[model samples]
Target: MDNQVEKKKKTNPFLTYFKDLGTAIAKGDVSVKLSMLFMGAGYTFHKQVIKGILVTLIEIAFIIMCIFYAAPNLAKFGTLGTVQFEQVLDPLTLQTTVNDYDNSFTILLNSIIALFLIVCFILFWISNMKSVYRLQVLDNEPESLTKKHINTFREDVRSLFSEKFHLTLLSLPALGVILMNIIPIFVLIAIAFTNYDQAHMPPNALFTWVGVSNFKSLFANSLTVTFGYAFRKILGWTLLWAVLATLTTFIFGILLAMLINSKTTKLPKMWRTLFIVAIAVPQFVTLLLVRYFFGDTGIVNSICSNIGVTEFLKSVGLVSQHLNYIPFLSSEHWAKFMIVMINIWVGVPYQMLIATGVLMNIPSDQIESAKIDGATNFQAFIHITMPYILFIQGPSLITDFVKNINNFNVIYLLTNNAFITPDQKLANSNAKEVDLLVTWLFRLTNDYYNYKMASVIGIIVFVICAVFTILSFTRMISGDREGDYQ
Candidate 1:
């Protein structure tokens, strides 16, 4: 028996759980088998009348829900609807009447809701099965033990406040997350598989499930060739912007923090305060102010024009003399460049503060050792400070990269009025030269009323962010080089 126990300990945990489950199933009597077909049979056999009735009520409710909501919608989920609204003449009254139209939006919304309900029902059914199996196993125990251990509804309620208090605390938050985040994500993903665009607007025209047709439109179709081109351009720019914004801010922020922390620097607090003021202002306000200042007729350009700076640039063959304005936001290359530069300004102060705190924690011994070895300041920084900061901030850098990919405000606000010129517009799409996938999605939904395309772009953006995040973390974990510093 001791040898068997020791051998069992060496077996896989999942294998053990299945083995125990199989044993319980084999030991189940007719009541347990009946419960599989009739949800509450085992509980009724165990004389838990209220529990049995409650379980049976849930099954009944699920049946009614399926019949009323889920079945009808699921049937139409394959083809959203076929009917379109049309005006018909009422012969007797000699008046025009609107015929009943199938609403595609209602169908899509209800189908998503029904799918959610079905999933919930399936989960509940699994729980019901598990409960029956658990009760059956308890019944097979010794009678005295079963009598002492068996829980009534009242006892279960008492256990929630006592032994299961953690579950009680977590339940509301878990439910909130499922309803708010998970359900919405599922709906977004489902929308991508349909044709719910402007042309298929509800109550006038019907939209249907098109499987991978939206994805195909994005990648292969000649009619949407411009969208493919726009996607490639935006994706490339998004990645480049994220990388540049993350690295440039990190490097410059660390340098600024180091400068302020140096003993020779006087009035460090004053210098830090000056930088903190930039961060203290709301980001939107700053971006808006910056945008205005850089506008053609705004203060910066006004001052430059007054000072003949624009004329000097034209004289030096930098810009055409025919143009009076610098075209900061109007020119695509200039706009992209200025967006990065402005992002650095807005982002650096926060990074500096973070770097300052991290820099303070670095052990003095390592720097002192490097100094004693006659290493130059640059060498010491490269070998010790860089590694230490990178090790500590690696995960944060990944998050920053992801954040920059979706940094809609910086790109959107700065060039909102200027970037979209007639020449830059995609042939059949809402995308422009300066638009990231995130901003493009916004334009598609809000400007073009192309929800299907927006949802597809949203899914693609999520995939890009998720893939990059996962790959970065995987590389960081697999390398495991952070331990070298320790």
Candidate 2:
């Protein structure tokens, strides 16, 4: 009975089909059996060609819909949102405004495209069904998978590899990367071409493709504000911040870590734990608390008043008479400075922890040998310790630099709405003083609802991060060729 059961299992065409599927996937090609089946049927080939034509037609139609119908309608929506209803004198003019019903051609084109996609998708579905049906027919035929001849083949494959566990483990992380990260990024990248501005907020109002106009306006010519000022200023500051923040944090973090690990210092664990406490707390909570302390009526100002720095500033007339309380978090330049300093406070602890771990891995013998040669502490650090730590931890340091560039919560929470200026002349509509590109992008989408620009900014951020990551990887593998570290 057992031998007969093994023979029946060996002849299972379901199992054979799976084995073939594995081989096809490994070779990065569709199953030859399925391809042959499609090609074998003249009707199937005709339908596939038709499906391709329909897909191309639908894409062209989608683009045309956006340019002719949706763009004009959306412009009307923007104009209406900007103007008061009572301001327009001509009833006919007002009727043609965004407040009027959506353009019928836009609706018709969209509906047609939607229906076209649905039909083509159904055709693909039908193709899959037909293939499955054919496979099942093959499975049932005695000549295809005979009941008594295939036991040895199954046993031979089982001895090779545990294919089930191998595939399951390999696919889990890849599936997560595709679904969670890659898909959202692709969708956001696509959104950049659309007219998803404040006026045409999605679900309530539809947005359409606007070509490269968003990038053009953002980079060079903008009707809303002077073209290059906002972009250049924000970009310059972002670059400056990335450099200063990383350098300041790295220099200080490494210095602190070295100091704590110094032979002269006592209670290393206690000092390390103290710094750890800063990083141990949620950063948002720490940032919010710091923001409040620096607010108009906050303790920092009250303490400054007691210390007579406020009186000194008042006497010097640095602060205007109208301004009674110091606006640490309010003034743009001051806010930028304060955010950087607060970043140092929040940032250094983690670097210190990382440096400490990396420092421990540095050979004690290297330092001992340097000290025996009558080298001072600083000389020993420079000649013996620093290079080893930097080599191992260079990647992390670059990552920290990238992290600080997009460090939203620290900048956003600390500065709050203070960076926002109501004057249209100030920025790319609704920008704040201390807003990083990420925070600015978030404000565009979340507050102002200018999703097209938000998407544009998102692409810019991606490019910046991608560039930095590539550079970091290059540096990590190649080392600092300048010979400064060595």
Candidate 3:
């Protein structure tokens, strides 16, 4: 019996249980445990359990405040002249007096919002408490007792915080994105549900919740003013302008860069510097200058009058000289065309600079080999240079396309608000005949004071940008590496 006891002691049941428990704890799934944590399914942390009780107490306090203190006093404030001048405190209990405007919608809405936030906080707190309890239970459970080794939660927390610095640096930009773009955008979206139009301006004229009425009235087929035409027209123009601007700028800029970089071209540096000057000058100044040139009394028309086109066409009896005095800035068709052309002028220089860089980087051996094979300059460019440049600059081109979409400075400065008239009846409020959605949104907020509509338009613009940004990010992150080939 003594010999048997000694042998069994080496293979003890307590030791066996501990080995099993350690294996189970080591192999436990974090995702499964995390799910259990949020659902209040198991106890994990002592601190969280304590916090949960505190939050429950706060919820009770908020309820009491709303019922006994807020609701009754609000009712009295709504009424006229029962010692209305004296501010009431706990009117239901007739406890004390407080202010006359205590029952204002502002106060009521604020209370509702605060209550909503408190409820959210309570829910989150409860979830965290449950998670903590589950984690704690897992940590405390012994290998000897439970037949599994428990993993310490602190190790996991420590590892998470100690992750690589490059990964952690991403949090700063992520936080910036949430604050700058997300918060303002969400606030604007919430504004769309309110009656915060020109009439019910805030501070003085309080805008209240109007629900989906604004959306229905604007978009529903039953409405008298079908904004469909205005929306369609503006959208059509925006798309047409974007396509034309991108293609023309790309084609001409590449052509010009290739031309100046060719061996046959003289004084390449001088010509390059000349183009660079255009890019260096502030765009607004150039656009404003260009706007003056297209004005009724501008230099372009004066030069045309001096040239034979105006008088020559008149002499051949093709048209009257009055056609020469056409308002380039005021006319819709003319303004749109002129803006596109002016964009090409202002845009091409920057593109030229980019193209030149890409062009210079192209392997000379590739070009020489193409030439040795008896390929023309155009063919060499098509096969060797063009592909190389495009591969290198595909991301830049995509960015340029996006820039063209929201290119407001040139359009706005060149045309001013002359083209866009204030038509409150329109969805975008007399968005210029040629105005992009962005400029129109600006006018709505700045000119008409229609913040609600402006916010809606802002949301639309955000959606468009977000879609493009996602596409660009996916392409760049997942696409072929240009530098790898080089």
Candidate 4:
């Protein structure tokens, strides 16, 4: 058993796949060999006429697409098009006629898409060869050679609806994933390696691959663009925000649920319903309304000003004495505080419902025993309630942390026109002090048209989230928690 385990661990599955490929090519019959050069040729040899026709049509369509759609872009992909955009005068009309220009972005995009399609085509061709080889082998068998035993196109269609139904169901979803998710992700990564900034705006200007220059710039400081400094600050704040946001919501939600559910509490149903009302309203509307409430000259400021609260704050040096209104969403510390507080307001109710459901399902005996042992309510809640909630919602907590890391709406909407970065380094880097990685990426792409740096930040965000999730989940499942829980 030990030897077998060692052998299994030593084996590389990818190498095994190539070994199988070699066997299929060398040992396959004549029809299979034909399939290497011509798709569906083996199907035709096996007399599957309808299937062969369909497969052949697919191959022909791909050939046409390569010629018309992929080739022109791919030809110029290396230099991302050399033709400069120009305008000319028509002597007769005396109108400026624009010359045909090669768009750099278009060339890069089309080339990546073409390469992806070629890879998919290669995989499909390999599968076709393997399939045809099996059919050719069956042809020599005494039973398989019989007409009654031979597989028909109609039978294959029937099988797709029966034993192979999953394939039919998954086909469209797989295509959608490739088009929407896979292709765009490839483009994003590819853009990280190039200089696709505002200066290289397509049609008028050209951007070329700068190799790892973007990545290097991201980690190193510059006088004009202090990206390394901005990244370190934004990354630190992003992580801190995610941790605080997730835990605050989760912990407060649990406490809220406990408070409402407690026998000492009055009108629990009314309280729960009130909390649900927050959930009923659209989040963006609520966020926008709150943005106004906390604005420089908004109602909150007016109330504070009227009550001498603004003066009190000014005396304490919390608000600037030079300014009349307190900078709730404008100042860095103040904005970060308000964002999290408002998020707790917006986010806690949903979590409360989740925590409420989980708390009810906790083993009653554990809580009863803790009480019997003279543990106070708070102690029992901490030792029993907290651990149980953490165990049940471990995956959810991880998801919440990741979600908060990329929570763009709250950060963007709250600070849209209100918040301005006071720090010169952050402002120069196209970042705000309170900006999360996701919001910074959005600002770089949407506001500044700095796609190169945005893509690099995007990749960083992906890596950070991916690494945390993998490590957290690995630790969660590797524990002997069933013993304790049961």
lDDT of all predictions = 0.83, 0.67, 0.66, 0.89
* Candidate 1 global TM-score: 0.88
Candidate 2 yields a Cα-based lDDT of 0.67
- Predicted model with the maximum TM-score: 4
lDDT, candidate 2, 15-127, per-residue tens: 75565555433432233234433432322232334433443454466557667755554555432233222223467655432344443224433443444444655454445
Steric clashes per prediction: 0, 2, 18, 0
**Candidates in order: C-alpha RMSD to true structure:** 4.0, 12.1, 11.3, 3.4
lDDT string for model 3 (268-301, tens) is 9999899889868898888888888878668886
Error of 4 at 355 (Å): 0.3
Off by over 4 Å in 4: 1-12, 144-148, 472-486
Clashes of 3: 18
Candidate 4: which pairs clash? none
Pairs in clash, predicted candidate 1: none
lDDT of 4 by residue, 89-163 (tens): 899999998878999999999999999888889888877777787777777676643535557999999999999
List candidate 1 stretches off by more than 4 Å.
1-26, 86-100, 144-148, 221-225, 422-427, 472-486
* Preferred candidate (lDDT higher): 2 or 3: 2
